[model samples]
Target chain A: MILQYLKLLKDKRIVLASSSPRRKEILEKLGWNLMIIPSEFEENLQWESFSHPGDYVVATARGKANEVTKRLEKCGEKPYLVIASDTCVSLETQVFGKPKDRHDAQRMLSLLSGKTHDVISGVSAMLSYDDGWHEIVFYEKTKVHFGRLAPEEISSYIDTGEPMDKAGGYGIQALGGTLIEGIEGDYYNVMGFPLHKFCSTMAPYFGRLVK
Target chain B: MILQYLKLLKDKRIVLASSSPRRKEILEKLGWNLMIIPSEFEENLQWESFSHPGDYVVATARGKANEVTKRLEKCGEKPYLVIASDTCVSLETQVFGKPKDRHDAQRMLSLLSGKTHDVISGVSAMLSYDDGWHEIVFYEKTKVHFGRLAPEEISSYIDTGEPMDKAGGYGIQALGGTLIEGIEGDYYNVMGFPLHKFCSTMAPYFGRLVK
Candidate 1:
């Protein structure tokens, strides 16, 4: 649907400031040329300080974008755009990131069993201008309903080791998909980026070509 | 969650009676040993003959399973199980399949623009018993909501050559994801196979190991 933007954005120096392969794959599907630059920002933000989980993720994503942008500028490399994103699973007041260990993954999965949780992703786009960098930050939330998981189920899933590197101790694109009952929002949001929201948000920057 | 069934089902001969790579990929994610044997049944069922789209798809899936089962029996190759599936996109009473040409794809995409549609998949699992074959059939539905698409956007999407081979003229797991606002139900269902539903439905055959 965005094929028209191919010519306009093809030559732009777009830097993706995250190490997530899922996010990179999503962007590549749109046929954009991207430069991968993992953010060096320490993700030690106090989740309790933020009033909402969405705010917390957006702040972290902005932190990543700022770090990568400044690092590039210091190197005298000014890119046209820098994109960063953070995803977390939240149940009520609690926020869950990657599991620290097998036990932590088991704990997180147990808590999420037979319950509905929110998959929140915060994205920041740093657009380079002659004067400075213009930042746009936003968050997308998707409701995920997990099936009733038995103790054995959680243990087996942990053994697979897929939960260790994923938020909420699960990756929806792989075997973790079997653990989910359904979802009530953009499916891509669960993967760490909101494709539709990102496209719509950046629609203005590409100019009103498609209308 | 289903790791317990690995040993029990690993040695068993499982034949998948469809050529769709998406369905094959979904099943493979479970770490199951699968034998790809695409069905020879022709998908020429009249859509108007059925009372509901779900019924039509189920009948089609059954036809595929029956054809493959009989064909294998003729060759004296009775596998443990045979699975067949059919997927279609329905906007109210109208059912949409693969687009015939570019104009047809544009027409289908235009009808689906800025609207919600149901992605229905019918599955049939045939198990061989001493007496004969025991069959289980079911259908899953997922609601997909698409964002408003401009004419150029639709044309450009068609140009990508993805719409010609996919039902509803889009693939939600690829560039089509950007065109979708959100979805309600198992995301895999929209991808041509309902992973969660398929796993849950076959839970009984796998036996109550986790309990």
Candidate 2:
């Protein structure tokens, strides 16, 4: 199905501006051999400043894309497109990034033990043009329902070290899967990238670029 | 989190009565060294005989489990438990198994495109008791909403040869992820196993067996 679209963009140089293995793996499903350049952007955005969690992640994703775009320009390497994304977990109004430490992970998991939370991922696609870059920003949200966790379960999960680098102190694709009762959206979004939305958004962009 | 439960079942023999790599991968997430013994049972159940799609799959799973359990007993090996599962795609009252060929896959995808269909997986766990075997059977349902797939896209997806071996003519965890708009239950259920439900069902049984 996507083979034709993949063939169209085969000659183009695509760059992913992040070091997340999950995100890279998600994008590679489109059959693009991506060039990875982890962005040096400082992701210290204030979550409270934005009214919506999606806006906060979009701002952070934009920061990563912009930083990587500038770096590529500095090196005189103009890639056809640059992709970046930021994922976060939110419980109502409060947003969570990666856990700072073990205690932080435990606190997040404890709070989310028997609740349903939203996993939001913001993506930025920076397309280079004749003069400058045209950036498209979007976000996808998935609701993840956690099974009631015992204190020992939380402690034991934290000990495995999977929660340290994931939002909401859990990775849905790993041992953390046992903790999730169900989900209500794109499963890939919870893994840090929204594969369906990303593919839909890029189809037209790639169509225009190829022409 | 599951390490303790896994430790309890360490010395016991566990069998998965299916040849599906996807199902095996889903179960291995619980840290079990499963023994594979694909059942010789013929899947010739009449979907019309069952009241619901879940019942139809549960019956099929029961057959597989019973056959594998008998085989193990004949070999003089009383395994701790035998896990078997059957998955199918249902739209309304109609059930779909694996497509017979590319055309059949295309037909299934066309009917499912832009519509929400149910992916139901029935699991049967046969536990050896002193006198005989106690059977535990349950089914999990997940609603999968697929994007409107173009004819070309459907043909291309079938070309990948992923749909022939999978129920619903698609594999949600692979190239088929692009075709899905969203899902509304345990993602693992769509992959032919329900991890959360399976874990919950086995916890109490494991407790009794270990004691």
Candidate 3:
């Protein structure tokens, strides 16, 4: 869907406001030349302050995008567009991010075993025009069904250390894939980026999103 | 779910009887040491003979696995287990495989645009034992919803040369991600190997299948 705009975006100054390999790899599909400027926004937003997990994630992503855009603008750097993303695991009203340690990962995994949870990803597209930057935020929620995990299984997976940096204590795109029974939505959302949603959301700005 | 058997499968002579990079990448998550041997079995079976696309794909995978197993056995190679897989696109009763040419790919993509199609993958696990070879076959279906595509867009994607070797004229794991709206079921299934289903299905034979 977004590949149609590759030529138009080829020369644009695309700034990816995140250093995540998953987000980078996912966005690379558009063939957009990108410059990574890790967002310096403090990700300490209070979870209880939001009415919904989706809103919190979107706000977080927007913060990242806005910080990157402002930093570039301060340096008089021309960035046609800045993209940011944030992902979290949610069950009902509870939200979880990366685990602090192996025990925490195990606890998160055990709590998720043999149950369905939502993997939510919020994305922000900050486009710079002649006047200023215009922003749009979107969220994708994927229902992930985890298989019953043995405590020993969770312990060993944590030993591998793949869960330490991933939200929900697992990376669906890797070893953690075995722990899942299946998913009911965009798998990329579970990978920390929402590919389809990003493309469709940016589709409307085809002519203007790019320089 | 399957990580428990990684140590057991560590020493087994596991061979993947296919050359699809996507399958190899997806299967690598299990940390299984693998050997790639492209099956020489001709995929010329008449599709019309099968009652369902799933059956045809499974039969095709079986053919590949059997041929590879026979070849390895003749060489006195101890291939403890061999895995082979085949995938196709099914829309209701109509089924589509890799496009024969650019025009064919364009045709397939056009038909799939703005419509939901099923990505069906059939896998065969041929286990070699002292007495005989035991074969197990399985299939997974993923519903892929595609966004509407213009003819120009299809032509451009085809021009990128990403659709030729993939089923349904798209590789969901790559440039084709933009074309998909979302997917329901195991995402790996659309990539040509069903990881979760493979692990869960082989769970019962854990002890024997691994070592």
Q: Give TM per candidate.
A: 0.96, 0.96, 0.97
The list of candidate 3 runs beyond 4 A from truth reads: A209-211, B209-211
- lDDT agreement with native, every candidate: 0.91, 0.90, 0.89
Clashes of each: 0, 2, 1
lDDT for residue B100 in candidate 1, whole number 0-100: 93
DockQ, candidate 2, comes to: 0.66
Q: Tell me the lDDT of model 3 at A101.
A: 88
Q: Which is the winner by lDDT between candidate 1 and candidate 2? A: 1
Clashing pairs in 3: A1-B178
Q: After aligning candidate 3 to the native by TM-score, how far in Å is the CA of B78 from where it should be?
A: 2.2
TM-score of 2: 0.96
What ordering of candidates by lDDT runs from best to worst? 1, 2, 3
> Any residue pairs clashing in model 2, and if so which?
A1-B156, A1-B157
Q: Report the alpha-carbon TM-score of model 1 versus the true structure.
A: 0.96
Which residue segments of model 1 deviate by more than 4 Å? A208-211, B208-211
Among all windows of 10 consecutive residues in model 2 chain B, the one with the lowest summed lDDT is: B1-10
**TM-score of chain A, predicted model 1, versus the true chain A, to 2 decimals:** 0.96
